[model samples]
Target: MRVKKDTSISLFYDMVELMERLRGKDGCPWDKEQNHVTLKPYLVEETYEVIDAIDSGIPDKLKEELADLFLQIIFHCQIAREKKEFDINDVMKLCLDKMMRRHPHVFGDSTASTSEEVVQQWEAIKKQEKGYEERKSAVDGLPKHLPALQKAQKVQKKAAKVGFDWKDINDVIAKVEEEMEEVKEAIAKKETKDMEEEIGDLLFSVVNLSRFLQFDTENILHKTIYKFVDRFKKIEKELASCGKDIEQCSIEELDALWNKVKMNARKNI
Candidate 1:
């Protein structure tokens, strides 16, 4: 029988059943051919689409993107079920059990008075659950493929929890400056590998500074890129107003136009 879309639970089961039908022998050849490896890209794509939708600040778009992401989860669960590994129910059960285990302050007798304490307790519990004694390092659990900025932040955070962080934000700032100087030295020596390594160190220090300041480095860079693109388009429009284009302008002329755009942007702000 077809499940009615009257409730969220029913809708979820409907999605699961739909995936099952799609992977059946008489169903989609493309869908049937897909395995966990083949679907990895789609999983990543849908997750980023959901992030983009949230960034767009559109409720309907976010809702649609969330559904798409959820579909990827259900599809993966269906594949696992086909292989007799696990299904959606098992997935949900494991997550629920883990949550209940992790949140001892909420679900058990443990007490966590502050959000910071709660976070610390959660990490402690997670480390214990993962057998901290057997792990080689605190950084062992970090995924290798995480984005560089995020990975740097995570590695720093993990180390910080174990008292490996700088005692002062000023120290982090000094490290950034030291890295910048090394980068300049590498450039003067014309060493490609040294320059690359110094640049990475500079960025890593900057990531630490951002975290110390309670900021997100990736989101900060994303906003900066958006601002640059927006201002560049305005520069293009202003140049066209004078019957000139960016390519037709001299370097000084282009710089003057860029200044005018920046002034206009500040005025609007």
Candidate 2:
């Protein structure tokens, strides 16, 4: 008996056509020339743009941004096909298989009564399927290429998973204070390397605190930076209204403008 395929054949064929058109001789030069390495920045940018669109709470923009991210996946698949490697179909199949294997509560006899139990089982199944050695720490699989803030969070979570974590939020808070003290000590010693290391430790401890408090450290930092940019832009506009550019403003004048913007922002909020 012939085995029946599980997905939409027409849609798969359409994706194939689209990929071929993009890589064809008459296709867009940039799309045809792009490879995995060249598309790395674009993949990262699209991911963040999607996140921003989601945070903006605009469904239309979120849809468009998600489409852009999907396009990157397709683009990468097209490049792989050109090299005679697996294509999009292989990717879909592998993902489906992995999901089915991981979700034994749904697909097999393994029992999971809560989301927490499901997560623990999923992690166990993932390790088993990946043939991860017993000696492999939970942090072993974290990608080094991740952004520093995200990497710090992932490292903290992995350590937490293995019980090598603070006892409570209070413990993390105390650790943060200790790390800050070390940072100050390094600053007082005037040792650049020590200061840098202490600063990193402080940031890492903060990431741990974020984890305990159920916050995404990366997202928190992003939101803080967005607020800063908005306030700084207000300051710039205020300066421009007075026929003064930022470069022409004295430090005192800028500080006053910044304070004004902060007060106005809080008032509006």
Candidate 3:
């Protein structure tokens, strides 16, 4: 049977029913066996894949990945329904309510003419939400599994909101320099524990500097990684052209090839 690709709302409920059947008593054993805990990894993986699809600038791939992510949400809702907890309807309703409540400028009589004002009002509304009112710190609600670099930025941003931040970008730069010196001191003293600790502090300091400068540490690092891989591939191709294996090249030969590749890359840019 062929499914229509039009904007029919019934198709959404049909997909929900499809998931229900997959977990039904007479359905596939693998689908029946999954629970919230067991599906955590795939949920995280699919979310990342959706992000990757978005970054790739492909609409079709984004659509497909979004469906995969939506499936994870549906799977969780199904598990909750089976346990006599809330289901997808409740989830949607809560999200709808929250959206209406948070955007008072749109849904209520509150006024916010600027994007910055809207953000401030949204945060204020969020703090007043039922469970959030008890948050002792602005950084209290960070997801435990967020990527380290992203999590660091969130923590720094939350703290900065409460005025616990550097007064200037130069101050952040100086802190990064101080952390680097500490790392060097740890290495020179051959203190294994201090080295580990100081290295982490140095990374945190760099993350702070990036956040202060309005740069995303993860995205910047990923771009640098992609660049390094591209340069290395070029070097490999150059060596292969001469019928030579990379392992056969000395450090000097590899460096020369790398420089040549770098020059070519610069010229292309």
Candidate 4:
């Protein structure tokens, strides 16, 4: 609260002004060359960096990553201003108006005492917005650029909202098992495209199961991927101790090491 009370608003404007200067006639050549399209990768990369900082549980790292993400927003706004479109003020005003409009419990007479009720209210209000009226499907607004796992989960969530979902957790589990069987059959056929498509279906079913259990599929997959990498690196380190290459080892040897490392991981837990 002290930080909020003592925060200087001028710092924000200063950063905005710096971005403008960077994109000006005599400013940085690279900055002047960038448009919203060219800076898309940086925006996505900075977003992940912010997520990483949060996962690391480091406040200072999160603050720095957030600033990097904010720079992407400022960069796009500056480019728009140069093209005679809206500026940062318009962006801030629109966001302010959106929050004020969405949270009617605080800004108006509407009442929502719980978080779930607030989300329902927000979605209801969103459907009444001008741009949202044209959406042909409940899942239409999800960004195409989202990771496949996240996109699948979001699509399932939209469908669930309209009661187009499995009525029981057992049904969800059954769907996953059914997909797995199809995947194995596809692999047995030795058809590459069929195998790929079946694997995708299997993954989509797993994402649905994760959603039913109220877990974030993308985050859970990330944890599994990192765990695999950690154990593999340990295997490589063990091989280095014996002055032998993993590639030179027999499958049986590698499997022996793998079981040992897996056992150690469980014991540590």
Off by over 4 Å in 3: 1-6
Q: TM-score for every candidate vs. truth?
A: 0.94, 0.89, 0.94, 0.96
Model 2, range 149-223, lDDT digits (tens) per residue?
888888888888888887878988999999999999999999999999999999888888898998999889888
* lDDT of model 2 at position 190: 100
Local distance difference test, candidate 2: 0.88
Question: Which candidate's TM-score is highest?
Answer: 4
Tell me which residue pairs clash in candidate 1.
Answer: none
- In candidate 4, which residue ranges exceed 4 Å CA deviation? 4-7
Candidate with best lDDT: 4
Summarize candidate 3's per-residue lDDT along 53-100 as a digit string, tens digits. Answer: 989999999999999999999899988999999999999999999999
**Candidate 1: worst-modelled 10 consecutive residues by lDDT:** 126-135
Root-mean-square deviation (CA) per prediction = 3.0, 4.0, 2.9, 1.4
The residue pairs that clash in candidate 2, if any, are: none
lDDT of each: 0.91, 0.88, 0.92, 0.94
Q: List model 1 lDDT by residue over 12-39, tens digit each.
A: 8899999999999888999999999999
**Per-residue lDDT value at 98 in model 3:** 91
